[model samples]
Target: MGFSTTHLIIFLVIIIVIFGTKKLRNIGSDLGGAVKGFKDGMKDGTDRAADASAAPAQQVGTAGTAAKETIDVEAKTKV
Candidate 1:
């Protein structure tokens, strides 16, 4: 069966006794910070992926123009 409210309270009390309130508080804060950092890192990675994909499209657009410009330069240099 699932844990009732009383069982949950008893479990929490045992945990607090094993690890004092101060240590538990610090542990809780550290866990929260880790979760926050992980979320931020995931978001940053997604943004970088989006930027990386966009960059290739722009490079492709420029590549076509660059090839045309290079041919003109070569022709002029020969003349």
Candidate 2:
């Protein structure tokens, strides 16, 4: 089963005893930074989708040709 409230309380108590208050505070800040980074990434992805929707549609053949060129470049670089 997933962690219930009681389980979470017990886990927090153990973490406090093991890590102490100062280390726990640093961990909280680090976790906050990680969450902020994830939010920023999601925002960037959403902006890209919005920009794509606003732009004109490109020809399917044009995209296919560009993709082939990119693959050729990659293949050359690898070798």
Candidate 3:
């Protein structure tokens, strides 16, 4: 048979007993925070994507901070 409201309540009570209310509250807060952060990151990503599409592509010849981050190296073959 499918679970009734009473069965769900009993299950919740058991979980609360095992975990304790303080621990359950902390877990709930942490899970909520994680979900909030995930939502924020997704929104930021979409905003960045829209901005990128609206802006013109930068020229490769001129480098900004990206230039400073790169290192030029000559590859050598061992004899």
* 1 against 2, candidate with superior lDDT: 1
The weakest ten consecutive residues by lDDT in model 1 span: 70-79
**Residue 17 lDDT (model 3):** 96
lDDT score, candidate 2, position 22: 100
lDDT score of residue 4 within candidate 3: 100
Clashing pairs in 3: none
Which structure among the candidates has the greatest TM-score?
1
Q: What C-alpha lDDT values do all the predictions have?
A: 0.93, 0.86, 0.88
TM-score of 2: 0.51
Q: Residue by residue across 29-78, what tens digits does model 2's lDDT show?
A: 99999999999999999999998976656655478788766745554654
Evaluate model 1: give its TM-score. Answer: 0.68
